[model samples]
Target chain A: MANDPISQFQIKNIVPIEIGGLDLSFTNSSLFMVATAAAAAGFLFLTTANRGLVPSRLQSISEMSYEFVASMLRDGAGSQGMRFFPMVFSLFMFILVANLFGMFPYFFTVTSHIIVTFALAMLVIGTVVVYGFWKHGLHFLNLFVPSGVPGLLMPLVVMIEVISFLSRPISLSVRLFANMLAGHITLKVFAGFVVSLGGMGALGIGGAILPLFMTVALTALEFLVAFLQAYVFAVLTCMYLNDALHPGH
Target chain B: MFVVTPAYAESNPTEGTHSEAGAPGGDAHGGGAFPPFDQSTFASQLLWLAITFGLFYLLMSRVIVPRIGGILEHRRDRIAQDLDEANRLKEEADNAIAAYEQELAEARKKASAIAETAREKAKAAADAERSTSEAELAAKMADAEKSISAIKAKALGDVDAIAEDTASDLVKHLLGGSLTKAEVAAAIRAASGK
Candidate 1:
């Protein structure tokens, strides 16, 4: 278990609670989730406290994140989609911070959990559905029936559209979860290889360098994946929100 | 295998407690579920995620968005005002240059006009002086001509008196007596006329 890669993801109870037979134990996963939220919010708050006209380095990063998410939302859903800015910004920051936090040794990756990712995905799709219906009423169903579909093939097209639409939450959640799960697992395996091989002999020590280098390279790639997955999550959220805004096409 | 079911929520907490009783290292490969799929932690994680995420969303919407947006907007307005000021300054400088050039041209025209008037005045004075000198020279020439005519008339009278004296003296010497003044004058006049 010293080199157990899967063990890194274990959720140990920090404070076990059983109220009314409910397992609401405060675990390492919960701790990191709170930490992720704090870090995401703290970075933005502390850096931009000055609100400098000429931004400092850290302040530039804060402003850049704001503009980055703003432009992403505007591009995906247009200016009218800005109503969802808070939600989209929170999701992006939370996932980004959580993913980066997992890169540390012995840290839990909150986003790697399927339920967490699914919840987030559902949150986005839920917004789309609720707002779509609220704004357009019955016309929101028109999203399933695209414009210019011939009456003959309309049913088949609509069935495909409905299936695709239903699969949005699944695909969105699984993509982030799978990517983080696979990347972390692969990184842990290679790092474990370095440790195990170095333990064997002098010759094995030399062999361990390859995996050591691989671990380093994979760490870099994981960083990229972390940011990329966050961006992907935000962008997809915007596009889905677009459906709520204009559901016809 | 990735599907989430509510049954695991009830089942895994017992397993979790059982695992906690076992060796810590046995948690990963022990007879428990994978950590991500371990439904024992789902309720806690979901609850915490909801709390923190909700707080985050509220903070973003209520505080951070307005602050950053205001900063950016204020910066944009400042830049626009600075640009407008620069344009105004440029226009003012252009007007100043135009005014200077116009004054310079006007001054040059006035200088030439003054020179032209002076030149015309000098020419008129020279013409007047020349005419006065010519008139004074003509008066002097007329006075000199009148004096010369008087002198010529007086000399002619003297010549007549001398000729009469010489003729009377010659008659007294040759014919023993001078003829009368009238006869002598008449004979001399007859000879000069012949």
Candidate 2:
């Protein structure tokens, strides 16, 4: 179908999916989310199943992934923050795998949706808040109150801090969603050019070849961006956690 | 541009059917259709978060951390063992040096004692030789004195004998031949200095 590319993002109602008249559509987005989770679990399981002194290929990859995340957490958050390594590592792998999976022809880009990205961002921010409170109690609020500030500027500083705090989720979610959506849109636009021009005469077809090359180039660049975005998300999460742990510093 | 028109036509059919069947609200199939916020999605997200957190925590705590810790502990043990061995070697070297010093002192003492003993023996031997030489010289002087006295006695005796013989010969001559031996001796005594 000509519309299949756009329709890939559509929500299809499945058996009403209701416990008590709640219209919960098991949409294409939901299906992709489940697929992403299953794939993540299977990949980790397969890679880590055979633990050996000398590593196989899969084991090497798993070990490398482990070291990568550990180093990142240690570098960004220090030894005291090492306890958060697992959460940050999982978040990175999950998002990276999901983004890569979405690049396939039949797959849906779950990160392109605002709700999914927002949910992930909220979780990271919420963890920072909750962990801060749990660890430091009411003293965590000292993060807003800058030390050595003049009494007159205290209130202004606190207001700025609160505004910055509230904007965290928006920035986090928007960064991921915007990147995913823009990359997909650009890819689609380029692909459309190639397909349309290729159907014309030889001169038009010749013109289409350039777009095809550009699409390939852009796709490769998108892959790199996908990996970088995951890394950025995980590193930022660690930094936020660090802030929560050591507030005023 | 030609591809865009065809894509719009294909998407429009689905939009028409969706609007006709659904409630009279905002367009569900519009270009900017955003799903309404549902609180239930939070529960799903939370569930996923919990599952992932638990699984990852278990992997890190039970599997990864322990392995790394074991490696570190083993390295520490090896280093400690090497240090202990080095210390032992150092102690052994110290002991050997101490032993060598002790033996050297003992040899010096023994050497000095032997030299002193040898010096005493040499002095005694020299003293004994000197005493023996002095005794031999005294005996030789005594023997020479005895020989000189004997020679002096013997010469005196010989001188007395010769004087007697000469006096007898002079008396015989003074007696005028062989008259009477008694008368001749008397005459010689009278003439000699009476």
Candidate 3:
């Protein structure tokens, strides 16, 4: 058992092809990411295809997910946030499905990687920036200035505001990546114990039972973490968008 | 931690050799077994992020938003149609109720008029019947008066005849023979108190 638990996190190139000195290669992680997206699409399409007035189980799940995100956007960002419902809802579903896919055996946890989470955070932050400028023009810069600060402390307050604004991407990315990485590492560690301990005699087998129970409990906890991380990401996105829209508040 | 030491000792046969070799951590795989972070991974991550973000944004703006808008618009239209139908029905009900009330009022007035006409006709008939009865009674009283006058005339003529006959008979009995015409006349005249 020389296999390090962290060693399994290698990004192996799936399709090895070199073109024009630039290695444009798809990796195992990329494959899983695509699979996660495809799964999300198929799940939504199948669940929402009928969309009957009286919903079936799957449709109800889809609708509940929809309503959940919609309510979050409404509550977090206010009524104007309704226009962005589609984007936020898609974000939630995609992240949730991707996270769940990662929880499976032999699957890559895309969210555990810094790059994937950073990209998602950047997109959300970029959208806020673009929309804010587009909607309010030069006045969007006023978001960094506090209205009631004294003239001498204005620069200090503005610096603080800018620092907070700049930290959005890091905070968002780290929150998701840390949660995914921690949950996966914990599961892997416990699984290793179960295998090693169960190989021994009856007492070892009895001791291994604790690790098995812990694994089950952790798996359940991971599932909750998956949903919670997705929710946190979506709600934070809404909050950022709200800030962009109503900078004074 | 003690239990894990035994399991580790059993797994690695070179545990003693590694311990003697002055490796602080007895694990065969080095602590840095995890691959160092590659710059290429960061680049790939950035590329994938851009791709996904673009794709998702396109899908949202093109596909999802329109679908949601259509569904909401259709729902709004359906609600409006329902409300219009309800309003139309309410108006029809109000018209019907108003018409019913008007008809009821008209019917009541007509019924009262009919009753009044019937009462007036009955009074006219009763008045005619009474007048006719009075006229008949007056005619009957006149006929009874005429009959009584005729009966009294007849009784007076009979009394005059009886008186003349009585006077003639009395004169004849007193004289024991037939009296002369003049004397008889004179006696009749004197008896009659002429």
Candidate 4:
């Protein structure tokens, strides 16, 4: 029972607080999210504290990450994308740090949960919606109306675009949540196999070898997935920002 | 260190269902899957996420990014200044080199002109000395010629006297008292065509 793979994701309330029938207690997820935030801030602070001309290793990394997102925004959304750099950069740092931290043995993975990921996804889509409408007014609806479509097929295409636009948050949040959830679960399952197999005799220990190797391999894969997921998130955010900045196509 | 409250652990409502189901899809959040699907905890996670995200964004955009940007800008300015200074110094050096070369060429020209004038002066002095010595030699040759002419004239006069004595002596021997001195003198005057 204690080795239940799904049990790893159960939220335990460390500090319980109820306000007007709303559960606002700090759960294990909140604890790690706070920790992730602190770590992200601390990292930025430490790396940039001494901005040397000939940069130290950490300073270069700080600058490189800054440039990385900067270029991404520039390339994906053009000059107009610079406006949202703060939000996108902050999101990148937070998700990247949180995902990497979750790779540790006992750490809670905040991004693995749908609630947290959906909130972030909502934030992106909300910004896109609000900014697009604020800046472009009714012309922002052109985002859903593809240009140059035949009138006969326009109705169908518009419906499809509308559905897809509405599903942005769902898809965005689910992609990250599912990837993290599946990868971690698979890793945990393999680890369980190794434990159960090793509990048997010498012959069972020999069988456990395969699962151990798979677990190690999966850990490496999970690390790659962590980085890749963060990259995908940032890139998609930029693409969404592009739609808002240059509506229509 | 984590302090586990005894009351919290004892009254966990969702514990039995989670361990029993072992399925991420078993809880009400089962469809959503996992802890986030657990509706009881959604508000807290979202609330904390919002708070933390807002704080992080503010700190990153306002504080950290500007500090790094400022440093980068300062360094860039410094580098530009260094480059400009180096260029100015290089131009100054080039001008100095050109000036030095001009000075060197001028010195060379002055030296050659001095040598040329010295050579002309030495040649003129040599020519003057040679003309003066030639003039002195001509004067000496003229004086020697004049003295030789005087000697020749005097010798001729003595020769005439000697010749008359020899002739008188020879005549006395031949015709004992040949002729008197006046007669000889008249004979000599007639022979010289006086």
User: After best superposition, candidate 2 residue B88: deviation in angstroms?
Assistant: 11
lDDT of 3 at A179: 93
Candidate 4 C-alpha lDDT tens digits along B1-194: 01123323433446644323332333454332345467767777888999899899999899877887777788889999999999999999999999999999999999999999999999999999999999988888898888898899999887767767877887899888876777776677688866
Ranking by TM-score: 4, 1, 3, 2
Query: Which digits, one per residue and each the tens of the lDDT, describe model 2 over residues B21-132?
Result: 3323334335323222323333333444445545654655566545544444555687899999999999999999999999999999999999999999999999999999
Model 2 spans with C-alpha error above 4 angstroms? A1-6, A13-16, B5-9, B12-194
Question: Which pairs of residues have clashing backbones in candidate 2?
Answer: none
Q: Which lDDT tens digits does candidate 3 get at residues B34-101?
A: 32143344444455556654565566556654544455456668889999999999999999999999
lDDT (C-alpha, whole model) for all candidates: 0.86, 0.71, 0.74, 0.84
Per-candidate DockQ values are: 0.30, 0.08, 0.10, 0.35
Question: Which candidate number maximizes lDDT?
Answer: 1
Candidate 3 regions exceeding 4 Å error are: A1-8, A19-23, A46-71, A78-86, A133-138, A191-201, A204-213, B1-39, B137-194
Question: What's every prediction's RMSD, in angstroms?
Answer: 6.6, 9.2, 7.4, 6.0
Please write out the lDDT profile of model 2 over residues A1-249, one tens digit for every residue: 442345555444443343333334455565666677667666666666554545678766766776787788888888888877767776787788778987898677777766677878888899889999999999999988889989999899999989998899989888987888778778877888888888888988999999899999999999998888888888888888888888885
Model 1 CAPRI rating: acceptable
Tens-digit lDDT track for model 1 on A201-238? 99999999999999999999999999999999999999
Question: Between 1 and 2, whose DockQ is larger?
Answer: 1
